[model samples]
Target: MEKRNKILNIEQIHTYYGVSHVIQGLSMYIEEQETVSILGRNGVGKTTTLRSIMGLTPPQSGTINIDGIDTSRWQPHKISKIGVAYVPAERHIFPGLTVEENLKLAARPGNGKDAWTFERVCDHFPVLAERTNQDGATLSGGEQQMLAISRALISNPRIIIMDEPSQGLSPLLVQMITDVVLKFCIKSGITMLIVEQNYRMALKVATRHYLMDTKGEIVKVASTRELVDDPEIIQSHLSV
Candidate 1:
């Protein structure tokens, strides 16, 4: 494979919540069109890492670079505007609004011919197209996840960072989401960073995996093939 340009970079990032340090000198990078995942059991600061990148929680120390620009102190909206999108596990779609309305609110027009338009996203997520007229809160958990992902795509972001996308779904829905995300990585060429407690789903979706320790640090970084070759890392790091 040819080398791709870097899109997101984190160097020794140390983030905090009221003086309680969560991310401890962590660093990583995502290249253009790469699918990267951070894997850990619950409460290992996986969400905080995404928050730090999104500027919802800025790092007190270290630097965050997005597309060669320093965004360590930038606000969340500004970070979002500059080609980064986040899909929180909470799936905060507007409950009272129709699915189409939720999508239109977040859409950003692009001059490129291949920009992710509403119709194109609908083609990818037919279930959301079916629920276009339905209220966001009225859809099943799986449909809402698809909507959240579609909304991000409609924005035409350079990279999409998802936090625990499989959190509240059943096994069937998890598999469905897994398939959707896998398709996105394989076909869309959209860069992705997934923070997942579901290591199985992450293993199937991400090309590279950052395994986190209980101390809120990356204990090991493994390629998907490496982890698959040695499944015991899952039992050691990701098992409950």
Candidate 2:
């Protein structure tokens, strides 16, 4: 299939955490209706790259284009209004609120008038519906991650940037999360950029992949088949 139009265009983002340069010239793009994965070891600028695109950690220099509009200068909320959603690695949920409440806060329109509803999100994760009244703090790591994603879906974004969606989950739950992401890309035609350390899970869900080295630089970009078949690239850049 010919690739869809680019939904996100992140070009040469240079970001810093105080005096430390974290992300150096990182560039990547997410095409509409496609699934892309950002693979790297810890502290390889994966999180920083997501943050830069989200405007939480603004880049000193870069161009962030969402559906063709350059939004590098926009604030986080403004960028979000342009149809981009971000789910951080930390799983930011309102600990005091119930799962239902969290989703309500994140709710927005999707492509047209047919946006995501609370029932639809619960249907995606039936377990969430079962625990609708449960407090966020009480949910398991995997459940929290589910809520994080459901929250993003409520926004009906064109492209969702996920930072470590599989972090700290049991193997079973990791599979669940991966399944949901793939379903979204296939069924809903939602574009996504996921940052994950679990190579196998990432490969299964991603159409294309990009690897960031320890220096916060993009080292490799390939199709999922190329990524998984070529073990040398993983050994060279991501071996622990």
Tell me each candidate's RMSD, in Å, in order: 1.4, 1.6
Residue ranges of candidate 1 with Cα displaced over 4 Å? none
What overall lDDT, based on C-alpha atoms, would model 2 receive against the true structure?
Answer: 0.85
Candidate whose lDDT is highest: 1
**Which ten contiguous residues of candidate 1 have the minimum total lDDT?**
181-190
In candidate 2, what are the lDDT values of residues 39-116, reduced to their tens digit?
999878888888888888899998988889988878899988878889998888998999999999999866554578
lDDT of 1 by residue, 71-176 (tens): 9999999999998889999989998999999999999986577788888878878888888989999988899998898888889887899999999999999999
Error of 1 at 136 (Å): 0.6
lDDT of each: 0.89, 0.85
